[model samples]
Target: MDTVKIRNKDMLWDIAADLHFPPGFDSKKKHPAIISVHPIGSCKEQTSGNVYGEALAKAGFVVLVFDASFQGASGGEPRFIEDPAQRVEDIRRVTDYLVTLPYVDEARIGTIGVCGGGTYAINAAMTERRIKAVVSITGVNFGRLSREAFSGYNPLGALEAMAQQRTSEARGGEVRVDNYLPCSVEAGRKAGLTDIDVLEATDYYRSPRGEKPHGATSGLFSHRAAAIGWDAFYLAEVLLTQPLLVVIGDKPGGFGAYRDGQEIYGRAASKQKELVVVEGASHYDLYDKPEPVAEALEKVVPFFTKHL
Candidate 1:
């Protein structure tokens, strides 16, 4: 794996990514490529980005695992901003970078995203025809998830808080940010996040399991405005025309379940689409566990090979 810098087309940010070449690859030959996008608050090294990238590379496809534009090693100000629109643009920009390589097959490019990155990938596919195929693992339609899943998800209250924060910022008040995941295992448990998803997220992002210097699972509080207004399922019936493969855990309840998969599958206008729910796996299990990650890769590798 080699680290490389990709500049967003807007010339606004430099995306840091890990490029994995297929075993015995020939630089003179063009190869199909896959872009593996990490989850929200995740970097190129965390989640299953590297897992999938390495696996696909071994299968003879070039893979690029990257951090989002504003987070991780990517350059951006008002750090940790998780704007969905910009995230979608970031995926396209990465695709832009991929096509520039002489050894990359421009017509056979595909993409995969995990967690919130999954949603961003879907949104990117809506108009980015360069993405011939799309795959989402444990996908979260963050806009919908924020409003529907959590019991205490209050849009009005969040908007009110965002308004207050905006006013305070205008007055030169101190910048305030919030962690996307629990600060610690104890904090997650104390906040009634004993569920598998929360526990695993806390462990993966906060603990040594998958922590990175820039991946603190935190973002600007004002990001609430973008989070609250963004919709991942903006035009599924029309623009989401690419073949889609939604992979998730089978466990009931949570964004990684079959229900969320069905929601995306139902809305997509793709004539060819599939949903694979890994048996007995929970939302976060597919993030890193060997069994679940392997299970997802089993489906993903073939899907892209066939489509792209």
Candidate 2:
């Protein structure tokens, strides 16, 4: 396998990398392609994306993974924006890059998104006609999903406070950032703190499982910008015409999250939608664990082989 950097003039970022797989000696045809997108605040070195890219590449598919704009080596102003809309464009931009390569079979291009990337992939696939298939791992439905709004605060009061925050930000004020991962959950701690979220996500981002200190960030979005766009369940309502695959954990009932995927799948114009729930798996297990990772990829490769 080989890796190379791609300069995207559209996003004005030179932060994309493509991994190439050598075709078997008997085959002289262009190889299939897959793009793996990392989760929010994550770079291409992430375990979830790296394994998927390298594994797919060795399977004779060209895999490209990259850091989103403003994070890692990518160029962008005001780092750590964590803008959902921009991330979808990043994935679409990758598709734009892949089709230009001589070794890539343009017709056989698909995408795999893990966690936050799952939503971006779904959205991009909904908008971009070039994608034939897609897979989302533990994807979050940001727009519709009931989020932890500064707990105990009145909804109306919170909105009023947010209004003031926005007013301040509009006047050239710095945005307030929130760190979901606190290393430890403190006694009588901050509202909306959950051990499950902090522990699991922090383990991956802070440890070798998917660690990359070079390109790490946290919640830096303007409360106003994020709130204004909250209604757009991120391509959730958009109809997808391509065959789609969704993988999620089955044990201990994390399936509630899959409801977002189901909602989208139900609305899909395509007849080839599927959902697979892996046994004894959690959302984060697929991040690095080899057994589960292999199992998940086995399902994804065939989908691309037949479609991309």
Task: Identify the leading candidate in terms of lDDT.
Answer: 1
Per-residue lDDT of candidate 2, residues 133-160 (tens digit): 8888777655443233322224455556
Clashes of each: 0, 1
Clashing pairs in 2: 108-308
lDDT of 1 by residue, 1-308 (tens): 78999985467768898888999999899999998888877788877455677888998898988888778888888788878888888888889999999999999999888888887888899999999999999888877766654314787787788789978988999888876677888987898875677777777778777787867677787666777777898889999999999998877555444566778999999999998989988877788889999999888989988998
User: Local error of candidate 2 at 156, Å?
Assistant: 6.6
The window of 10 residues in a row where model 2 has the poorest summed lDDT is: 144-153
Backbone clashes counted, model 1: 0
Worst 10 residues of 1 by lDDT: 144-153
Runs with alpha carbons beyond 4 Å of true place in candidate 1: 148-151, 253-257
lDDT to native, each model = 0.82, 0.67
